[model samples]
Target: MDEINSSKQVSVRDFTTNAVQVLDPGQDVMQWTFGGLSRDSGHFRDADLAKILRNVTAAPASAFKACRTPEVLRIIEILSIEQGQKWGVCTLNEFCKFICLKPYATFWDWNEDEEIAAAAKALYHDIDNLELHVGLQAEQAKTLWPGTGLCLGFTISRAILSDAVALTRGDHFLTVDYTHMQLLSILS
Candidate 1:
């Protein structure tokens, strides 16, 4: 941190001591790092999973850079305390609600139990379908998006954990406890 402060090129707009927000202070916090796990890992926005599936999985690593953009920054910013309060995050519940109402929705249209049950059967086989898969249960999904706070449904951290579990069950996944947003991406 002192080195960061000393660097002429470094921005001094903010500083921290032990993650407690000593400079430009607001919340009490600490930092954590997830690294050096055996299994492969990558960080991504919910919106960017499609891009990753298309580019990184389907094409090549060189094709990956095209999908990284400010839009991702904006979406992730919704999870940070600094910006989340100002620009509310998109709730998965709200997104689902929109799906139920929107005439252009590519997924299930009806809200009734029978229709939802039928849709569930269809989605069960193709669980990777983004339009249908939100990792939260019904009650949790209804929880108001804690704007300027963490997403009420599945968090980015949990998503990473889920990815690790999916790839190699019981494999260790590292993550930090701090609420301040951080980015972790695996290029490969």
Candidate 2:
């Protein structure tokens, strides 16, 4: 906050130079990310803030080796999962069935990683017990086909597409020009 208030506007060239200097993979790119830079004594540096911005926007997508999320965050995540379950959120298998896809028989079906599957099994006990949102985040991004650009979780992608079609079909505003008959064919 201090940095934002005190900083002067910088030219595009200066911004680009700073970004290039930090984004060099040979350097410790991970140190510039949100979790790494100092927040000690309840303060942070302007250069650290700038580095974080570059890391978020310009860093390579494949650079992440691990989540590196703090242990405290895992406790918060557990609370979130409990709250979602309490609110009657469906399990991942249920959601898959609802979407006309086959329900996953095991955690292995959800993801190939043995460690992730083991963790899910320890927490949820079975595939049917896995929470929807947790599975959405944990599942590997499916390569739908050649040339399909976006790398998204399979269930998340399906849910978004389902919601989009439902919105188009149910909303009177979106159907103003296209006939409901034609909309069916197009959305279908």
TM-scores for all candidates: the values are 0.17, 0.53
Per-residue accuracy of model 1 over 1-188 as CA lDDT, tens digit each: 55543333333242223333443345322322223222224343444556545665573322111122244233232234334335654443344444442221222322223544355447543322322222232112223344633322233334445667666643334334322243323322
Against the unseen true structure, what C-alpha lDDT does each candidate score?
A: 0.35, 0.71
Stretches > 4 Å off in candidate 2: 1-76, 144-149, 178-188
For residue 9, give model 1's deviation from the true position in Å: 23
Candidate 2 local accuracy as lDDT?
Answer: 0.71
Q: What tens-digit string does per-residue lDDT give for candidate 2 at 44-119?
A: 7778888878987784444111132344244445557778978999988888999998889998888878888898
Clashes of 1: 2
TM-score of 1: 0.17
Q: What number of backbone clashes does candidate 2 have, counting pairs of residues 3 or more apart or in separate chains?
A: 0
For every candidate, C-alpha RMSD to the true structure in Å: 22.3, 14.5
